[model samples]
Target: MTADTAKNFGPAFKTNWWARAGWLAGFLYAAYAANYLDVSWARFLQGLGNGAAFLAEMVPPNFSRWELLAANLIETVEIAIIASAFGILFSLPVGLLAARNLMPSWITWPFRAFIALCRSFHPVIFAILFVKAVGFGPLAGILTLIFASIGFIGKLFTEAIEEISLKPLEALRAAGAPFMSVIIYAVLPQVLNRFIGFSSYQLDANLRNSTMVGIVGAGGIGGTLFAAFQRFDYDFLAAILISIIALVMLSEFISTRIKRVFQ
Candidate 1:
């Protein structure tokens, strides 16, 4: 190689003092937080013993209350389905509007801000607010999951739209097609698979969250589970937990199959 080229390709190693200082600061802060929180080996050992005793109490699961269990499961499933449907429907337009590549800044900024606001709070917090507004019931749970779905699926959909090739879009636009027609022919087809994937995943997540929202009086199996915990009904709590696990697994399997079929 020429001397100039060799010099250009010289060793690419350098020490970053800022990175070293950042790491040191992070370690120091972590140590301080641990001390502030009173975290120690003794506390960990005590927690382990308490956890073991609790597990022992939950040895046998009881499910004699089949009617109650079935009713609550059905309600939870309904909440998830309804929320997923509405959330997906509403998110499509919002997502398209929010795609920076497709829309002008005037259009994209507001929708982007809305999506951000939706995602700023956790579902449980939303459930609390909805419960206060709508009173305790499945309605509150549905609203909570709907916003959660919109926030998550909308962001992903916007990203998917942005990543699509602009060639097809340009071709359709050149053909003097209306805006909706262009979306149908050029945009939807390209992002359909990913949209389906995101929808399915959101549905699964909604199902899990539906169960928990009930704890805050949003209405689902969570209320029952919370009651069991308060009453120290360990066997019943075990049964409820097992049922939730089974439901989550079943939803995952179904979603996987649906994705495979579409693929």
Candidate 2:
């Protein structure tokens, strides 16, 4: 090879023996763990047969309880809508406050802390807690999803605000605009599109999670579906699963349309 080619290829071709050894050790450890856990080909074959039987039982979904299914679906949608609305509304102020470039340390720290706390727990866990506190219903689901949305969108929104062009804000300040006016004129324009994107994404995520929170008795079709599974009502479970799929697809389509319109 030419001198330049050899020089360029030298570093690229250099192997890290330590890293390769570590990977080999990890593979050996995984095998040890599998043996310790008693995982074997016999277990794998048994699982496959069980899975096949389960699939066979789920064929020919029952739609006789369409009305009940529809009602649960509606409730799930309501929970998503209400939670998303509140989350978006509340996130705006908190996100703005948490933006380090915009707000003082006193203001930013508390809001950042709150966002962190909200994000620390999963929505399903939050739903369970809320249900325990408020009793079983969609209210718990709504609150859980709201917290989830706040944690996600609020953090992103604050970062977006912080990264904005300060030149426009400086111009607004020089123009003798009040803080709120500066935010409206300088800050809003830069982050509004991103805020829209975040909100839409949160809405989509909340719709999917709302269905899941119900498995914990927070409320929604998941609760009914879980009950059906316990009773071996696979036909009903199949129907519910189909409806959920349709709902998610429809929501995804709507969210895409909304994003396009705003864009």
Candidate 3:
């Protein structure tokens, strides 16, 4: 190209005016929000000091109530396991029904809406409702996690089914296979690995959420932990926190192993 023609060309990099405006608007809105909330450097520094003091009080954690801790931990595990099983079992049919490629729009719509409803609220909110309805305990916790697992894994499961190659499904249908047989022979194999992965991940999530639901009286270690905090038993609270951390880590490790085995 001639030097004059090259010079007439615009710069290699062009500015995105819309993006710049969006960023500026976002920054201005953030500043406005901070101002509206009365956020200040003085309060921030005070919060830091209070946080440091709280950390100091958490040292040398106490686990004196080992019996109580063990009982609640067991309850949490039970809630997680039962909820995971129920979620996986129920999600399969609902997910299959929701898959647009498999089921008609008329059939998928209601199931899809149900899944959306399940996912609309946080687990804690569900726990609160269940606690009120059931009058508290592990049953409430289990029910809460079950719906949560359905909301999460069900959507993924539908996507997984939808994404499967249709050739195998068509071949099975052409070979005079029944719909159920096609699902068993053609659909399940294609999506089994993904389904297992989703279930394991959901189980891990249920375990973590199970601990928190107890705070709302759904039943678990969270209730004990909340009581400790209310009584200002920082050492006991520290122990409970540590135990929850350890439980979560252990669940993560187990989930990883399960995924590896499937892979």
lDDT of 2 by residue, 198-261 (tens): 9999999999998889999999888998999999998889999999999999999999999999
- Backbone Cα, N, C clashes tallied per candidate: 0, 0, 0
- Residue-wise C-alpha lDDT for candidate 3, range 1-263, written one tens digit per residue: 77776689866678899999999999999889989999978999999999999999999898898889889899999999999999999999999999999999999999999999999999999999999999889999999999999999999999999999999999999999999999999999999899999999999999999999999999889899899999999988999999999999999999999999999
lDDT of 1 by residue, 9-53 (tens): 765676788999999999999989999999988999999999999
TM-score of 3: 0.92
For each candidate in the order shown, give its overall lDDT on alpha carbons. Answer: 0.94, 0.94, 0.94
| Shift in Å, residue 253, candidate 3 | 0.8
Off by over 4 Å in 3: 1-22
Per-prediction TM-score: 0.89, 0.90, 0.92
- The TM-score of candidate 1 is 0.89
**How does model 2 score by TM-score?**
0.90
Error of 1 at 179 (Å): 0.9
Query: What is residue 50's positional error in candidate 2, in angstroms?
Result: 0.9
